[model samples]
Target: DTAVSQTPKYLVTQMGNDKSIKCEQNLGHDTMYWYKQDSKKFLKIMFSYNNKELIINETVPNRFSPKSPDKAHLNLHINSLELGDSAVYFCASSLFGENYGYTFGSGTRLTVV
Candidate 1:
């Protein structure tokens, strides 16, 4: 079974369009995070959640948001998307510890035209 999975593996939208990516992890991990990979392939942390509580925001823009309905689900919602929002969004889950590595989803490719 897939440990972590995200919906809409590929997304193509126009500027100003709103979209959302759904993520779920069956690993029973309490901690989940959302990361964005830009065209330059630089990964940046967007948000982190621990058991439905927001833990880190990473200074992400107000247009982007992360919502965790439960320990196993963390979803990303983007509003008023811009051209600069085109990138790969990845969802990962891990135990709340440094030593425990994360299990990431395949990633959602968001292309804002």
Candidate 2:
């Protein structure tokens, strides 16, 4: 079974369209996060939520929004998709108050065509 899951592994769309990517973790962890990995393979943390509360928000565009319905789920929604937004979106989870490594989901590749 997968520790984390995200939909639309490959997304192809025209610029200016809105798209969303959903994520879920089954590792019984309290902290969940979203990350974006650019073409250069630099992964940056976008948002993180613990117990349904946002804890980290990095320098991301306003067009990117993160939603957490519960402790085990966090989703990312993007508006007015742009070519620069094309990247691999990864969902991850880690245990709070513990030095545990993050478990990453098979990323979603977004392409602005």
Candidate 3:
């Protein structure tokens, strides 16, 4: 029943470990986004890719990368995890234009120990 589904809802790892979060949208939206919410509860847009093309690349660390194999999928890969990397990572999808509306996933909680 999840329009947008992401794997590993909870992730606990040590510093320097690498991890990946997979997101898939069944709504057939043209654009997909990755957002990160820190412990302070501040949401930051990490990346936005439309139709498998890199569109919005925000100011994020090099350890983070977004990959879209097709329009329905967008995955986030994080390398060299750190304690500061602990956050809730959200995946969203939306269509562009006047009817634009975002459909977000439940989010993946990452705890870096």
In terms of TM-score, the best-performing candidate is 1
Model 3, total clashes: 0
Ranking by lDDT: 1, 3, 2
In model 2, the worst 10-residue window by lDDT is 94-103
List residue ranges in candidate 1 displaced over 4 A: none
**Least accurate stretch of 10 residues (summed lDDT) in model 3?**
94-103
lDDT of each: 0.95, 0.94, 0.95
Better of 2 and 3 by TM-score: 2
**lDDT digits (tens) for residues 42-112 of candidate 2:** 99999999999999999999999999999989999999999999999999999986678999999999999
Tens-digit lDDT string for candidate 3 (1-113): 78999988999999999999999999979999999998888999999999999899999999999999998999999999999999999999999655788999999999999
Ranking by TM-score: 1, 2, 3
Question: What is the per-residue lDDT of model 1 for residues 9-76, given as tens digits with 9 covering 90 to 100?
Answer: 99999999999999999998999999999988899999999999999999888999889999999999
Candidate 3 lDDT: 0.95
TM-score of each: 0.98, 0.97, 0.96
